[model samples]
Target: MNPRFTNKRVLLTGGASGIGRATAERFAAEGARLAIGDIDVTGANAVAAELGGVAFAYDARDPAAAPQLVEQAVAALGGIDILLNVAGIMTWGRFEETSPESWQRTLEINLSGPFYLTQAAIPHLKQCKGNIVSVASAGGMHPVYGTSAYGISKAGVIAMTQSASLEFARFGVRVNAVAPGGVATPMHEKSTAGRGVDPAIFAEAAGRNMPKLTDRQACTPEEVAAAIAYLASNEARFATGTVLVLDGGQVTG
Candidate 1:
């Protein structure tokens, strides 16, 4: 069978690790030409080398970096057929306890970053009728304790996804998001590691807000990557303004 993404050019953020790395690998396997951007220069370059793609040093929190990253991708790959907004950060704290710096930083990385990247890539996406797939979180859809800032940032992503979908449908460019619950990623591990939040509190929160499924395990990066791939593929041509929740019944149950 022919590869699903043969001749497609894809630009991805956070491509050094976690869901972004997995998604990059998947796209490469499907014959995509990739341009990976991440703050982890060494890691990004390594992935790019292995995948025969290009890598850029990117800080999603920087507005200037957004256009620069897109420009670099376009220059390297000729044009972009897909954009993946997978770079984000999370901090654990209740609304009252969350520091202003933490809140601002979370919003900048998780929400504003995607927004900037999308704005920069829109023209290119329009030219190719390409689609975008963002990695939102289930926390956005439901209240999760000690994740006020993180959840709000993801909620903005969900909102942006739908808004972009509607505004860009006339251009034949689709925008969609995957609202995954806890995914087993280094990002998650690091976020909780140094944070003073009690581990039991997270467990309690998860018990209340997550995994209505029998297997309450966090999702694998590959699983979320697969969902993202589906949303970006021609298989989902008719889908737009859609938030595919991969939260194991978190919303429903």
Candidate 2:
């Protein structure tokens, strides 16, 4: 009955779905004060009500909106100690088949969004000596044939985590990423865009990302949420600039 996050304040992005939602629930159960944000205001509000927190409609892809979002979250949370960036997108297709617009949009949501949010949250996070945990992808570490855009964006996330960790550690801020492989979520279901990705191709990609121990299966969003919680906790105080790969041994090979 000991709470790991008693009296802590957290500002979570993408808190309406997937790993983000799971993370928000986990933080709430641990006694943290929470403020959830997402493009889906209705969904965010629903989760916020359940946690006794507030929700804000946020579009992370818009850099100019980050400061405002951070202000709103901080206002709700009373202060910010954790900035969890879990919002992301998957653009599944061949590099040649992908449009420039799609590629840019993917990076904007998956990479730039986190970057801008972090920039705006830093002063607040610095005040509390907080940490950041981003949801990266196994595809970032081990590229999938048709997921070039998504993979690149996640790779950038890894780099950002490391670089930001290095720069922010001096100020007592930790930065890390959780790289999950083929997590079973709504985002995963949307992996196909036009002609649809081939089942064999998808299976092969999963096989490559998940090793024998996983039986080539996707993990639940809750599992990924566990990793994020650990990284954000004092248990990982000495850890920073790290990518915690929850890839089921795929990266090991």
Per-residue alpha-carbon lDDT of candidate 2 for residues 1-253, written as tens digits (9 for 90 to 100): 5778888989989999988898989999999999887999999999999988899988877888788889997777677899999988777767787898989899999999999998999999999899999998888988877789999999999999999999999999999999987677788757632236666556656534445464746678999988999999999999999899887777765
lDDT of each: 0.91, 0.86
Flag clash pairs in model 1. Answer: none
Tens digits of per-residue lDDT, candidate 1, 172-220, equal 9999999998788997666535455668657666557657787755789
Once fitted onto the true fold, the runs of candidate 1 whose alpha carbons sit more than 4 angstroms away are: 190-206
Instruction: In angstroms, give how far residue 124 of model 1 lies from its true place.
Output: 0.6
Per-residue error at 30 for model 1, in Å? 0.3
Best by lDDT: 1
Candidate 2 worst ten-residue window by lDDT: 192-201
